[model samples]
Target: MSSVRLLIGTRKGAFILTSDGTRKHWDVSGPQFAGWELYHLKGSPADPNRLYASQTSSWFGQVIQRSDDGGKTWNPPGTKPEDLMGPDGMPKGESNMFLYDTSAETGKPLTTHQHYDGTQRPWEFKRVWHLEPSMTDPDTVYAGVEDAALFRSTDGGKTWRELAGLRSAKGHLWQPGAGGMCLHTVMLDPGNSQRIFVAISAAGVFRTDDGGRTWRPVNRGLKSQYELPDPDADVGHCVHRIAMHPSRPNVLFMQKHWDVMRSDDGGESWHEVSGNLPTDFGFPIAVHAHQPETVYVVPIKSDSEHFPPDGKLRVYRSKTGGHEWEALTKGLPQRDCYVNVLRDAMAVDSLDPCGLYFGTTGGQVYASADGGDSWAPIVRDLPAVLSVEVQTLP
Candidate 1:
């Protein structure tokens, strides 16, 4: 009787939302590519009908769709949008490849390093901010981009390859974090598939154990003082989200840009649990598929008022992992409600009384099949929620 396929990503399109495991009667179909910009959509815990999408656009760029019947129908794996026409055949639109690797092996040329005021900048091609499939290879996948790099595709979303050793290991001391150097968070260690973990928003968490070639800066004891002046530097520090609980894969959970961190050892080091959290200033940090110390966040109302604090809307639940917190607020929306929760939006679903999804920026998408105490709104208004994944069909 398994069912529940949420996979939403908005700002314009891509939704799926089904239900049957009684996720409370949902069945919404989608905005499906109806204007593009679906920052992420994932499925394929081995192959739940395989699905992947990153569609994007500035006017039309970065496609990467794919969906083998799970997401209804989608294409673009080996090209087919009129075959990317041209020569007057019409559609010669978005496919300029997405390059980066202007030398690597540290042989320079990512504009020769620099930056921090030294300036040098080059590698551009934005879009795709998180889409990781392959917890066992449904054609494998992983793509997190935007000035920050990391790409791979083992034949499921057409082709892509750029594990350029995480921009040649240092990528010249990464920067940009008002949300530009986006690698948006990617965690895969279902008990060690080579070990991987990423999150970069100013450049903070990074770890690779021989898989993505090599990567380091685990940002020890992360502290951002106001976005680093040396707030214990190891990497600039912005990290808006990171969560792990594949049966305790070294324990890690963060939602920085303010605080609410933990890292038993996998991330090397990190500490502020943001205890009693009311305003640890937030984004998204979740865990608790089966409660590996249970975790989740969504405090907001800081970093210049992103919303939710006295305007209500809470969802704090930390069952002894962090410094203690608990603010579920049954059915949510505590008051005027201002909305803002992004950092891959928020997700969790291993069913059987462990489901808790999230999405906002005022477009709503909350859910909680008995996890965060309570909540609903399987989809409300749509169009601003940027990412949220879930796939448990059968």
Candidate 2:
């Protein structure tokens, strides 16, 4: 059997964790792009050997890097398809920048418009919120940006085409909450390349079955915590992360802002699964690749404080369709724990029994070999992790 490799993206850099699929011992490498903010890291399904990382720097702006030799070395794409230019050598008018304002200051725009000037250096590129490789064609890729724009690439990362269908008709009506309405998650159905699912912050979820030709809101049965009166109102919910079952195409799960929901009919509707979960305030949700009935979530205190419940770190698992929950932290930190796992920081393996992986704001990576029954810290003392993914080598 091939060894399992874990790719971790953090605020400080990127890390790789490899194991022999037997012991507690793990080999860790880097802080790749050291001191840079690594937001998302993924391995291309089209080419498992190829790895992609989305990074941003206070001085360098946003960029995506690819590595062929695992995590040993990485190189930025020669030409970022998302950075398209017009005939006059100026970047496309759609090119824009987003500035996140998390301070108490009010009346300030959460993001501002930034235009591309010829005087700017070539290395400066647009931010990538989500990156997806076409399942039908390896040369094609898709990227979603913070401006809520969708971009498509036919020649890998060398060129791009903007898909204007995702922009809201009532532009600027959507406001950024705590995390903003960025398109952070894009789910592509493996069975049909034309069908796609995207998760947004304030706007909820969207579905495009005709390969982005047309889009519709799939936020039915979801809750919008920002709204008064009925917080569990459908169609306006704030969704953090979405996970689809690998074997069952019709089953999917979502980690919402105030509740955990599962849809058995491919996201057309949903039902609350938060009855057994500790709290609905968590960010990420991970479903087992082999077991469609099993799902995992890390719950934290949902209030403004946003800390681990009971000041303890735990991973909760539901084996019977969210009817009940069990704590999966055996060897993890027991006391005074305040680490919070974000929306994209948790993942599960493709192997049988399925290994589970999750990263935290405390800069630690936890792994479980026998499902979510037990856990251990594989890597520590790194930057705050934003996302984690696992791939089994052939």
Candidate 3:
């Protein structure tokens, strides 16, 4: 029997939940590195024992911490891979410099931001959208930020470089949304490491077949926010999340602000899979590791209310590629439950029977071992959870 370890990243810190494969009993620990907004956590696919956490603070900005001896103790690197330039270092012809200056001049200090500090404030570090390990090389890693940029690290998390492809697109620099041009999700194809897929908020989806050397918007068949929209408009669509099936390379699913879409042709084209899904207005979508047609989603009321559906909590599962849906809430809460699950909160494991997990804004973590037929609360009474990940140890 294999034991499972769950890493829960929350608004205040992180919690490690260990359970027997049955998930019958759980041992939870932490508030690990308190005062930091833990956004993303993942264990190295090649080395299950090593862990990486993306943390942000109001005073310290953003930092990635690593733990080799499980979650026993964490070590923050002396210098972060990504660098934030001071106002004096702003280059000429940079339009964003003004916004950066205004933010620095008025909004406390840059170090108080998410990527800089581990503190939480109403307005700091918009979000750390995605953390990905390099499929081609385990030592390499990538992180996407709300500022609509990609940070790459070749030496695990020791050093970093910003990908110029996104920052300096041809003819025009990508404009920032309310949270700036945030790159929430970065999808890398394991088959072809050079081919990359990135989803940007308010910028639709982009694909680069030439290894980030170039990128093109692949938002065909996707809806736009504008009332009158171009059928082929590649920009202006807000994508909440994107998921790829590990077994099938071509099949992909996306949770959009307006619809759920499926692409059998590797994101070149898409069709609405939102048929049985609640309302086409939620963030985050998880796919089963072995079953490409099976996926999970937690729907909420739109951006305004953004609470559980009808103020009720439910997890919808679509087994036939979104052709139909089923709600799974066996052990979940009922009545006066208004917790909201974010774009990165829900996750699935690659176990044989498959493990389903999701974290809530109410500071709780739920796991279901037999798919979504039933569920159990593994960890409770923590900060607002931003993301959840599970890794099997040797």
Candidate 2 ranges with C-alpha deviation above 4 Å = 79-126, 168-172, 225-235
TM-score of each: 0.36, 0.85, 0.84
Write down the lDDT of every candidate, Cα atoms only: 0.82, 0.72, 0.73
Task: Return the lDDT, model 1, position 49.
Answer: 79
Against the true structure, whose lDDT is highest?
Answer: 1
**Arranged by TM-score, best first:** 2, 3, 1
Candidate 3 Cα outliers beyond 4 Å, as residue runs: 78-127, 168-180, 225-232
Error of 2 at 35 (Å): 1.3
Give me candidate 2's TM-score against the actual structure: 0.85
Score candidate 3 by TM-score against the native: 0.84
Q: What C-alpha lDDT does candidate 2 achieve relative to the native structure?
A: 0.72
lDDT of 2 by residue, 291-328 (tens): 88888888889847677888889888888877588887
Expressed as tens digits, the lDDT of each residue in 18-45 for candidate 1 is 8888799898888888887798888878
